[model samples]
Target: MENPIINVKNVSFRYERENVLENIDLSIPKGSFLGLVGPNGSGKSTLLKLILGLLKPQKGRIELFGMPISKFREWDRIGFVSQKANSFNTGFPATVYEVVASGLTKKIGLFHFMDKKMKEDVISAIHSVGMDPFIHRNIGELSGGQQQRVFIARAIVSKPEILILDEPTVGVDVKNVQAFYEMLDKLNKQLGITLILVTHDIGTVTNKVTHVACLNKFLHFHGDKEEYEKLEEKDLSSFYQFDVKVLSHEHN
Candidate 1:
């Protein structure tokens, strides 16, 4: 069998003087949607940054697409939708099309201009996230969920093979949260884009991701939903250091 799309070996990281991640090892198969879950202060975001090469690990190595992360020059292969990135003033006068078009900067490079095909691709990506109706609207003027969709469109505009999302549904309403996950499901299934999501939205994401990685300064547990079923509620509570109720309806 071939290696996974993403492979981390004995990785650890520190911030300033404190250790954030320790002895982490995992392999994420291609096209898998993974949910990284943990309580506050747990190195969830730090792990994502390490994978993105924003931060170098203090130990071990990370590989993407079967190559060292440092050697991967094709940045367009990975897309990122940061949490709270849409909270910036949508009222800043940039239209939705402009916002989405900005993501093509890497693919087109800095010196050249966006050609006709690139523009069409931007529009197509926006439509993929169901934000076509607001293509010309000022990004700041849209609601939270709409703004999130616009950011997602920006990510997809590059046609990335992998998508990394950090709390993509924050500040959205219940109905929109459902819509957001549905859109994610569509993107993963229809586009075959691998998704790695960092979120605290347990109930909503438990059933959505193909695999789950629970982290809190250390690897707590990671596997499919069935493996999670084998864990007792008390054990989970102990791992989290708080009361946790695994809802039957949601997990089922």
Candidate 2:
């Protein structure tokens, strides 16, 4: 078996004298599409931040790519799109190509020109998200769904091993959400990128992910999709402290 790409052992976090997460343990292997579902204030975002090395846990440990997060300096291996991504200023005034290329600025450095290979990489990333035609268009002119794709293109431009998105479909139109997920499925299966999605669309996401993690200050359940599907809706509702539903569907 392959080593876990992300490992969390007995992790705990607190904020303003309140515990957000308690004794959480999780392991994610390569090529896994893990969906994190929970109600408001369940610490789902907190956990993602911890794994991304943005916040330190008060107790226990976290490892990324087989190395302790504290010691993991190869940040390019992970790509993150936060919940606020949908709120980005549509009037930011930048072309899709320029926005995608900006993802490499950290590696390319400031005051440096983009060479031929770098430009080619940017184009390839745009194409991967099916945004090649919009490459020369201003980002502000694109629709919400198109803009989200641009953000995803930016995230994957570096060829990261993992992609983490928090509520990526929040503001997207309902009709476009399915297409967005299909694009993600391609990125996962075709590009071989591990995915960790934090979403509230539990009913819809369950059918698309390989694994499901139910969280509410602590891990209520973590298992394969088949096992998750076997669980009763009432049980899931009980864990969430409210009524919950898991809709079933066929994946294309």
Candidate 3:
């Protein structure tokens, strides 16, 4: 891309005796919905952590908006959505509005009441995710798919320019997966948010994401969807056995 929003150059990371990522170079252009796919333990989460500034790479450099990650202090410009089911308590006693409103904690600071404008932003975010009807409903009472959208609203309520989602659909129903992705497409196309999605739903994402990056410790491929789609299906099925995670989740 001419001027990427996020850039990684020759980045290598490891844990204890194992190397997770090696000499990886990747860039995310503004307004691009890039899907990051690879096998489990191929450092997908590690790479995300590096980009989120949760962990630093042992070698090479990473930049956010052309600024070195170490010096890039505009964290509010980015939003992150993690696999919620693993951590969120289904019985948490909070309404959807209350849950989404909490996203402003860092931006609005602690113990301060939200201004009317902030409340409007929260409601608008919920509307954008098509969850405004359930604004006052209990979070735990909602289905997995509904909860997922609420969390996304929470992430975008702050009006972040970039959204990074790591397996955000793990608990969603099979039937609702496409709808989830459609909402993501809306966020990218309508809201103009840059998205870096680490996903295994290649069969669906290929139709939505602008770019695709195949990772297996080493980046096997990084290109536009059309270029990736042009590869023979048989070739992918045969050559990418090393990355079973991608092949296993190609469900349409």
- Highest TM-score against the true fold, candidate: 2
The Cα RMSD of model 2 versus the native structure comes to 1.5
Candidate 1, residues 39-157, lDDT tens digits: the string is 88899999999999999999999999999998988888999988764467755889999999999987788788899999999999998899988999998888888888889889989
Q: What is the C-alpha lDDT of each candidate?
A: 0.86, 0.90, 0.88
Q: Which lDDT tens digits does candidate 3 get at residues 1-252?
A: 688999999999999989999999999999999999876787899999999999999999999999999999999999999999556788999999999999999989898899999999999999999997899999998988899899999999999999999998888998878788889999999999999999877676686899999888888889999888876665455435542332323345
Tens digits of per-residue lDDT, candidate 2, 64-125, equal 98999999999999999875446879789899999999999998998898999989999999
Q: Candidate 2 clashing pairs?
A: none
Report the candidate with higher lDDT, 2 versus 3: 2
List clashing residue pairs in candidate 3: none
Model 3 spans with C-alpha error above 4 angstroms: 242-252
Q: Looking at candidate 3, what is the lDDT of residue 11?
A: 100
Go through the candidates in order and give the C-alpha RMSD of each one to the true structure: 2.1, 1.5, 2.4
Ranking the candidates on lDDT from highest down gives: 2, 3, 1
For residue 204, what is the lDDT in candidate 2?
76
Question: What's the C-alpha lDDT at position 174 in model 3?
Answer: 86
